[model samples]
Each structure stands twice: as structure tokens, then as C-alpha cells.
Target: MSQTVDDPEGRLVSMIMEANKYARFAAVCDKDGNILWNSHRNNVDNILTLDETKQSLRRAAETWKVRDTLAEKIGRGQYAIVGYEKIKRITVPLQNGHMLFVSIEGEKPEYIKDIMKIVDYVERNH
Candidate 1:
């Protein structure tokens, strides 16, 4: 996929979608959980409705707020993972209070490494 120079966050989503075939959905949201950019793999159906997704992200943002309060004592959060039977959800904290939300297929443990590579990409480029 070609990336537009002006849209770094969009490019980030595109790059993430291409990073691994198992990647089902990728998104960048603000501290308030407003989705800035998002993409679902072609032919993949959404597992949640738009409103549901927004609400879910808002909850995640709230949790991150709590995490931030505890960061000084326990160190900053790198990422968080929640696995379900159908998919694995990974949330990575990004610069400027943005969050990267990614969902990949299946529950394979090894996929974490591949996802971490994506996290590394974000750190290096964004």
C-alpha cells in the first residue's frame, strides 16, 4: 500500500494492517477514545458496531488514565493484551497520549512477537 506523506497516522494504520496477515483491525485513538484513523482488513467483517466500538474505546481510555496515575511508581505501560477465543486485542500506548488498538486473528501466543515488532515500528517512526 502506498502512503501519503501528509498523513502519518493514516500511514501508521496502513503499515500496521500490512505488517501481519493475522491483523484484522488497526486504529489510532485519542486519550478520550475518539478514533482518529482505523482500518479493517479487506473482506473482514467488524466484530462490533460503530457505537459499540466508540464506547469500548472510551472505556479503554478511562483505564489508561488510571494506568498513567500509577506509572511513576511501577514504570510506564508498554502495551496491554487481552485474548479471546476468536481474536487477540493489543493496545499500545503511543506518543502524545494516543493509543494504538490492534486486533489479530486466533489466540496464538507467538503472535505477540510480531505485534511487538509493530510497536517497535511505531516507536522508531512515530
Candidate 2:
């Protein structure tokens, strides 16, 4: 599969998607909200669109900003989680101003732990 310049090897996107079975959507984006690689499960009703990806990236950037500011005031942030009526978004900051984002249906606590494990694995390997 072809990957963007930011994700030449597509490792980040692969990592996100492989993190858990419940992951409805996953993507890696730069700090400026530019998508590097995006993936979603087939046969899903809520397909991720270009505009939605852009919006997701923008929200992730904003969340990062808040995380950084809060970290400065308190301590380093571990991760950020945003819950919606239908899906929950989990974001982890990666190296080189890149971020890994995953959206899952409903609220599953175990999914968060699984995704975090993948995040740690990516950080260690990549």
C-alpha cells in the first residue's frame, strides 16, 4: 500500500489498526493536522471521509496543545481520551510531532489498555 511522506513505511498506521479488534478507525497525523496514513474496517457503516479525517486531525492537534499546556502546569501527560455518544477517541503522541489516533465504538476500557500497549510497542520499536 502507498503511504504518505510522513509515514513512508506505514508502520504507524499499521500499528494503530493492529492495536485492537474494536478499532473502528485509525490514523497517524502530523502536528499540523496533516494525515500520514489512515485506515478503517470494511463493512462499517461509519466510513471515515476526507473531511472527517481533517476534522479528527484538527481535534487531535487541539487536544495535544491542551495536553502540553497541562503538562507544563502539572507534569507530563500519559495520553488523551475523548468520549462521544457513539465512539471514543484515543490519541497518543509519537516521535517527530506525529500522533496516533484510534476511534472505537461505544466505551470499552480494555480497548484503551490494548491501544496503549500498541503505542508503547511502536515507541519502542519505531
Tens digits of per-residue lDDT for model 2, 10-33? 665666565566778777788877
Question: How many angstroms is residue 65 displaced in model 1 relative to the true structure, after the best TM-score fit?
Answer: 0.8
lDDT of model 1 at position 99: 87
At residue 122, give the lDDT of candidate 1. 61
Residue by residue across 11-102, what tens digits does model 1's lDDT show?
77787787678888888899999999888888888888989888978888888889999999999998888888998888888877888888
Total colliding residue pairs, candidate 2: 0
Tell me the spans in candidate 1 whose CA falls farther than 4 Å from its real position: 1-5
The alpha-carbon deviation from the true structure for residue 61 of candidate 1, after best TM-score superposition, in angstroms, is 1.0
For model 1, what is the C-alpha lDDT against the true structure?
Answer: 0.80
10 residues in a row with least lDDT, candidate 2: 1-10
> lDDT of model 2 at residue 100?
77
lDDT of 1 at 37: 88
lDDT of each: 0.80, 0.72
